[model samples]
Target: MKKVALVSLISIFIAITVLSGCSSNNTSENTSKVENTATNDASTNQTKTNDTAVTNETTTEQGVPEKYDPPIEMTTVGVNYPTVKFSEGESRTDNVWTRAYLDKFGIKLNYKWVVDDTQLEQKTNLMLSTGEIPDFMNVTDIQFKQLYDAGLIEDLTDVYEKYASESVKRMMTAGGPIAMDSAKFNGRLMGIPYTMSNKEVADVIFIRQDWMDKLGLPAPKSMQDVLAISEAFTTKDPDGNGKADTFGLAADKGMTMLNGFINGYHAYRDLWIKDSTGNLVYSDIQPEMRAALQALQGMYKSKQLDQEFSVKEFAKVSESLAASKVGILYYPPYGGSYPLQSVRDNNPSSDWTAYPLPSIDSTPAAPQVGASTNGYWVVKKGYEHPEAILKIMDFWIKTFYENKSREVMEKYVTTPDGNTPWLLSAIFSYEGFFNVDVQQDIKAVIEGSKKFDDINPIAQDTYTKVMNFVERKDEKFWGFDEVYGLHGARAITKEVYLANNLFTENQFYSTATQTMGVKMATLQKMRDVAFTKIITGAPIEEFDQFVESWNKSGGEQITKEVNDWYKSK
Candidate 1:
C-alpha cells in the first residue's frame, strides 16, 4: 500500500493554503459565550416555538445572531433517503440536527412534509404552483429561476454578508465567479448556491487491479493499451469462473461510462471548448467525435462492452459490477462509494484502482466537469427573518469547521452507525473544493509535515473512516479508504490531472442561453439519439447526418447565441 504522501508532488504544482485563515482557534465555550448573549423578554418565557412568540431585538456579534429569546418557528420541506435512520424515539422532525436548531438557536424547524428524494422535484413543483412555499427551502436551479421570475423568493444580498460566518464567506467565494453568480438572478442574490466538490464531475478510470494482476497486464498508458486490455478482460476470463460470462467494460443506456474513453480521442461530450479560431464550439459536434463513436461501435460489435448496455441503466450496470461480471469503469472520485463499494461488499478481497484518463497520442486526455452550483437555498420573499436561515447555517459551519472535534462530530454530524445526521438539517452547502482539499491535508499529515489534529474536519473524518477499515477491516469504510487513502482516487485526480492542467470544463456557464431555454432540450435529445444509434449499429456516416440535422434544427441558432454570450464576456 503506497503510503508515501504527495507533499512534493503538490508543492511543485499546487499552491499551499494557509489553514489558519479558515479554522477558528476559539474554544467551544468561547464560541458559545459569543453566540448566546441574547436579550430576553421576561414577559414571555415560552418553550414552544412559533412566529408569534415574544422576543427582544435580534442582533449579530461576529456573524452569529443571538438565539431567539422566546423561540421562533420556521417551515421547510425535506427529503429522506432510504438509508436515513433515526433513534428509537426520533423521526424526521425530531432528529439530532433539528434538535440542535431548537436547542442551540431556539429555532423550531417544522417540515411541512417529508417525502422520498425521488418525489421531491414533483412535490416541490406542485407546492410552487399552489404558492405554498415554506419560509425557507432547498430548491433546484430551475425552481429558483421560477421563484425569482415570480418575485416569490427573498433577496439575501445583505442578509448573507451580515449573518454568514467569515469561514462560510471564504468557502463560498473559493468556488470562483460562476458558482456565486449561479444563485444570482438580475443581480439579486436570491439563493445560497449549493456548491459541490468540483472534482466530483471529472472522470477517473476505475480498473479492476486484481484482474490486471491475474492477466499479467501492466497499467494502461494509452488508448491502444486500454483497448487491448479490454479485449483480454473480455475473452480471457479474468474472473476465473471459466464460463465466459464476464465483460471487459461497464456501460449503460445513458452512455456515461464512455466519457473517459471518448476523451481519449481528445473530444468532450456536453461541453463548450474553444476551437482553433478561439470561438466557443459545442464539443459533441466536433470532427474528433466520429472516430470515438466508430471505436465504441467496433467495441460493441465485438462484445468488449456489455451486450445489453444500450438497454440497461447505470444502476443495472452497477449490479453487473457487484456480481463480478465486468471490470473497467469510468467515474468521478466518488466512484468508490457506489459501484466500487458494491464490489467490496460482494467480495471483500476485490481491489479496484483509480487511474488518470489515458490518451490516444502524446497529448493527455482532459476530463470534463460542469458548473459547480447544483442547487440553492432560498427564503420566501415576505419571511420575517430571511437571515434566520443564515444564522442556522452559521452554526452548521462553525460546528464542522471552526470548533471541530470528535465529540461534536459524533453527537451532531455522524452517528456511530455511519449515518450522517447533518443531512437532516433544513439546509447545507459544502465547500466547493472540500474533497480535493481534504486529500491534500491527509497527504501532508501522513508525510509528517502536519499533525493529525491540525488537518481539517473533513480530512479527520475521512481518516477515521480509513483507520476503521484498516484496523477493523470494517466493510462500510472500505469505500472511504479507496478514495481518500494515500494512493486513491484523489491521488490520481489531484496529483495528476488537476495539478498538471490536464482537465477541462464547460465554458458556457451563464445558465441556459437565449436559444438554449427555447431549443436546447430538443437539440440535446437529438444528439443523444443519434450518438446512441451510431454506437449501437448505425454507420459512422450517420454522425455527419446528425451534425447536419442538428445544425438545421436550432443548433445553429444556439451556436450563434452562445458565441454572442462568449463575445459579450
Candidate 2:
C-alpha cells in the first residue's frame, strides 16, 4: 500500500512539470508574434509618410507652384533710379518688394550690386567685361545685343514657354507681336522686353486755359488756330502782368516745338512713316518736315518762341514754365504730374488743359507713337534656373493687376504721403498695364457702380487727387485735376485712342543697324544742327544739303538694313 502511494505522488509531480513546460513555450511564441507585428506596423507607417512627402515634392515641381520646398536663392543687379524713394529702414534688398519675392516664391533675390540709373549701363558693361555677370539684370537694347554677341546670356525661348504664366503671355501679346519681336534675336527669345503703352506715346497739346479765356480765343483745332492762339498768348499779355515777359510756346533744346507741333504739321522727326509709295521713309528728310521747319522759323521771327530756346535744356525750360514765362506746351498725358506740375504749384490760378494735336488742314493730325521698349530683363548664361525670372514677373503682374491684394497695396503701392509709387520692382511691366484699369474706374465712377474706394488702390489715389482738385479740397491737387479729373488729360488720351487717331511708329528695329550703330549719333548731331540753324535764321535751302549729306553718310545703308530686317519679319 505504501509503495503504491509513493509511485502515485511521483507520477503527479512529473505531470505537473510537463504542463509547466508547455505553458512556457506558448508564452514565448506569443511574445515573438507581437514583436513581429509591431515591426511591420512601423515599417508600413514609414513607407506611407515617405510616399506622401514624394507626392508633395512632385506636385511642387510639375505645375506653377507658388512656393518651393528647399527654397532657391537668385542673384540680380538692379537699377536704383533717382526717383525711387524708400522708407526709413528700407533698402533695395530689404524692402517690401524684395521681401515679397522671397515670401511668395521662395526666391531670395540677392543683389550683387545696385547703381543709379545713370551708372547702370556703365556698371553693367564693367561686369560683362570682367565675366562677373549677375544671375539676372536689365539691359538696354544695345546692351542686350552686346550680351547676345558675347554669348553671355541665356536663350529664354524654351523656359519662357514652359514656365510663363498665362497672364504674362497675354500681356506680352497685348500690343501685338512687336513687344515679343523686340526681344527675339534670330528666332530665339534672348530677353523679355519692357514695353510702354501705345497711349503713353500719343502726344497732346497742353495749353493754359486761363490764358485762352483771358484772350477770348477758342481752343485750337488746326495749325492756324494754334498759331493764332500762340500769338495771342504772347502778345495779349494773357498773364495780366502787362509785360512782354512770357513766350507763346515752351521748347527744350533736345526736341524743338515738341512732338505735338511737329505732328500738327503732319511731320514726324526721328520716326519711320509710310510714304505714298507704300515704303517706309525717314521722317527727318520728308518734305513735310521742311514745311514744319519753315513754320517754326516764322514763329521765331515773330518772337512767338523763346529766343534763347536753342541753349535751354529741359530743366531750364521746366523752370521757365514754373516761373510763368510760357503759356503753351506739348507733352504726354503724364506731363501733368511732372514739369507742368511745377507750373500749377507756382501759379494756382493757371488752368492747363490737354487736346489732340491740331490739324494741318482738313485732315486732323495723327501723331506717330512708337512702343517705347525702354529695356529688357535677361538672365546670365549657365544660370541654374532661368525660369525664376519669369516667375518673378508673374508675381508682379498678379499682385498689381490680377490679384489686387490689399496687403500688397498697403505694403508696396501706397506711399507715406498718401500717394502711390510707380513700379518699384526690378522687372519691367507690360504695355498698357493701367490704361484699361483707369478707363474702367473712370467709367465706373461716372456710372456710380463703384466708389473711389472700390477702385484699384493706385487708381483710388488718383481718384482722390482728382476729387480733391475738383472739389477744391486742396489747392495742390491742381495738377491732378488737370490729369485725372473730369474732362482732363486722360479723357483726351482715351478719346484719341478710341477714335483710332493714334499713329504708331512703323519701325520695329530693337537695336541700331550696323551702320546706324556707328553713325547714328553723328547723323543725329548733323540733323539737330541743321534744324537749329534753319529755325534760327539760317537758309531754308540748307535742309536739302543736310538730307543729301545724311543719306551719303551711312543713312542709305541703315535704310537698306532696316528694310531687310522688316522683310525678314
Candidate topping TM-score? 2
**Per-residue alpha-carbon lDDT of model 1 for 1-569, expressed as tens digits?**
00001111111111111110111112111101011001111111122233112112123545444777688899998776554577899998898778877876788999998876557677888899988799988776677778888999999998887677566677677656666776776677888876544543377888889999999999999989889888888999998887888888778787767788888899988888999999999999999899999989988888888878888876687789899888888876657655578788898778988888999999988877655655788899989888788777666666544443445544555444545555565666555455676677777766778777676444665665665677788787777677667776867767887678676777776657777898889988999999989888999999999999988988888998999877766
| Model 1: lDDT to the true structure | 0.69
What is each predicted model's overall lDDT from 0 to 1?
0.69, 0.66
Model 2 scores a C-alpha lDDT of: 0.66
- With a 3 Å backbone cut-off (N, CA, C), the pairs that clash in candidate 2 are none
Give lDDT tens digits, candidate 2, residues 280-385. Answer: 6788998988998898898888888899989887678878888988888886554565567777778877878889888888877877665445567889899988
lDDT winner among the candidates?
1
User: After superposing candidate 2, which stretches have Cα over 4 Å from the reference?
Assistant: 1-64, 80-95, 417-426, 430-436
